[model samples]
Target: MAEETVSCPVKIHMTTEIFQEETEKIELVLFGHYYEKGGSAYLKYEEMQEAGKIHTVVKVASGRALVMRSGAVSMRLDLREGSRRPGTYENGYGQFPIEAAADEIVHTRTGSLSGQLSLGYRLYMHGDSVGTYKMKIHYEEVQAAK
Candidate 1:
């Protein structure tokens, strides 16, 4: 059987909580695509900011998830069950190493190609545990106009 695929309008709402003190939120409505193949699923989208455009790709596999972003701020994060991965955070000024340990990672599809993702992880910088974070992503396909 061929894998399923979907493409439609999407609204992305993301929040960042750092050190259990700082919080930031970004909500954007744009077009995105979702597809599943070879036992993995992918979500592709783009984010626009004042500095530049950020293209984000999210890949989901069994017991693992990866989020990659390129543009103004760049990062490649790996979230595997009970595993720690080293990543780099880059900006115009400089770059630094980030250690990410995921406590739990889940990507579930409620419909054929739409669902929510929830992740909980610990973040370390400079080899020191900085904080813990929880990220949730919920999206659905937008209906087309008549």
Candidate 2:
């Protein structure tokens, strides 16, 4: 059977924690679009930072996820349980090699229009460990106004 594609406006709440010398936390609430196609779910959104605007796409499959960013900052992160994936990161200044070793990846679908994804991984830059990071994303489709 062929899977049907579905799309809708969504509100996303994201929290990221980095554990290095110290703990750092970042949170964001964003409005974006959520879609499912070809057996994968995708969330597309844009973020504004000091440098410029960055577009991000998060794709989640059965046991892995891919995060792609463009614009001001560009990177592609491939995350899977118990595996290390090589990728690259680039900004205005230069580009560098990066990798992610995912310790855990959990994706749960609460409903037809809502879901959550949690990832725990170690980040590396230039073959050096940067930190251990955990990212949680909760997204739900926006309801139409009455």
**Which runs in model 2 stand beyond 4 Å of their true positions?**
1-4
Worst 10 residues of 1 by lDDT: 10-19
lDDT of 2 by residue, 1-146 (tens): 65658888899999999999999999999988889888988989999999899999999898898999999999999998888999889999899999999987888989888899898899999889999999999999998789
Candidate 2, lDDT over the whole model:
0.92
What are the lDDT figures for the candidates, one per model?
A: 0.77, 0.92
Residues 38-76, model 1: lDDT tens digits: 777777888788879998888888788888989998988
| Candidate 2: C-alpha RMSD after superposition | 1.7
Best by lDDT: 2
lDDT, residue 100, model 1:
92
lDDT for model 1: 0.77
Give me the candidate number with maximum TM-score. Answer: 2
For each candidate, what TM-score against the reference? Answer: 0.81, 0.94
**TM-score for candidate 1:** 0.81
